[model samples]
Target: MDFLNYAFMQRALVSALLVGITAPAVGIYLVQRRQALMGDGIGHVAMTGVGLGFLLSTSPVWMATAVAVLGSVLMELIRWYGKTRGDIALAMLFYGGMAGGVMLINLAGGSNANLSSYLFGSLSTVSQPEMTAICVLAAFVLLVTLGLRRQLFAVSQDEEFARVTGLPVRALNLLTAVTAAVTVTVAMRVVGLLLVSALMVVPVAAAQQLSRSFTATFAIAVAIGVTVTVSGTITSYYQYVPPGATIVLLTIGAFLVLTALATPLARRRARAAAAARPAGDPAECSIPATRGATDEVGV
Candidate 1:
């Protein structure tokens, strides 16, 4: 309650809530796509964008969002059609962007203190305008992700099948990539570029351990994201710690605990579900039909 009393803390709560919802929503797709490292790639690109924004005297987050979106689209394109290795492409951008950002920052004569804030986490640095920007972008990310859930799921589950089915596989891939980029931007404000992906990926991983289906995992990841964000923010306030690191550490801790318990609990539940099924029913053990009542993309 005391944490909520301060205006900055109020702003932090809102920021955390928005990212908490937005990050894992997009994260589910990234994890499903097996591009979990995409966040790290995007993070490095964002550093370059921030440096350029400082040079141009613009809002770094907006610059980072635009660059990251563009970067993501290009990433999809290269991976889709490039002769070179996809991971190599991502790695090139990852390292090159960070190097460029350093040079750009030096040329721009930007402050080390300000740059450090983006690299790490700094709740005090979040201003009113930044908070509002995070909200708008985060909301947009959530809307697109949920709206295109089916198509996105198809693309991730099997790109060839999705393309054959006339699902606009390329377009859906681009859209999801951009949405993830936007998610990366919003999360950077709370978790910093260095560890933004942890907030996005860790919760989803934790949820995956416990969930038996895609929808259940998605819901659980969002819940975990919110829980960690709120709890970490409050704890950071009282402990005088960096909120971004605090939030991420809590998420990691949750994942560990979930790992310790999910296996046994999942085994028991699986047994119960099997017991509920008739022993002679072969259909119950069969795979679900394409996009059936129980969408089995991840489970």
Candidate 2:
């Protein structure tokens, strides 16, 4: 309660809430497209932006957003043209981005301790400007994710089918990638880069255990994301744990609990379905072999 007296804590809570909302909003599409790890890759690239920001003495959030967006677009292009070997190219990009960040930050005279704050999140250090940036970025993510849900859903579910249906599949894919990149930046302050993907992915996975449709999954995931983020923030404040790690652990806990609950619920549904059937004796019938046609008689 005393923590709320501080402005930083207030900002951290707000940032957590926004991160919770936007991360899953964009991530559900990635999950649907079977690209759940895209957030992690984007996070890796964002580190370069953070290092660049330190080197240039500018805002890390915006720089991370720009770099992450570029990396996501490149990844999408690789997916488009790199074919079966795209994974190799992506691997290079991921490691290269990380290495570059480490080098650039060192060049900027920033120590690993400084980098670690961004890597694992230091919620109490969130500034007013960072909060403003987070809010704006989160708004953009929500606009893209919620405003274009159907088109994105269509593309994510089946690209070829979406293309045939007259949707601009490439454009939508680029937008989704860009949106996810933005989400990575939005969450960077709350969960940090290393764990942002967990926040983006785990909530949606947890929601899926209880939902049968995309709309339900989206709603439930967002709800769960908000819940865990807020809860984790408060817990971290009291327990002196890292907010990012706390939020991610809570999300994983939610997933495990939901999975356990869903198992029995699924079995119950199966049993109910089986019990709903009308019982009757099996009808007896036999078909004559080779002589069937000739032996057939009019009733």
Most accurate candidate by lDDT? 2
Clashes (N, CA, C under 3 Å) per candidate:
0, 0
Which model scores highest in TM-score? 2
- Can you write out model 2's per-residue Cα lDDT over 53-161, one digit (the tens) per residue? 9999999999999999999999999999999999999999998998898889999999988899888887888999999999999999999999999999999999999
The C-alpha local distance difference test score for the whole of candidate 1 amounts to 0.87
Kindly list the per-residue Cα lDDT of model 1 for residues 1-299, writing each as its tens digit. 77777899988888888888988999889999998878878888888888888889899889889888888888888887876687788788888888887778878998787787888767766898888889899889988888888888889989899989999888888888898888888988788888888877999999999987889999999999999998888898898999998999999999999999988998899799888988787754556557765565675
| Worst-scoring 10-residue span by lDDT in model 1 | 281-290
lDDT for position 289 in model 1: 52
Q: Could you tell me the TM-score of candidate 2?
A: 0.92
lDDT of 1 at 97: 83
**Candidate 2: what lDDT?**
0.93
lDDT of each: 0.87, 0.93
For every candidate in turn, the CA RMSD to the true structure comes to 7.3, 5.0
Q: Give the Å error, residue 36, model 2.
A: 0.6
How high is the lDDT of residue 276 in model 1?
91
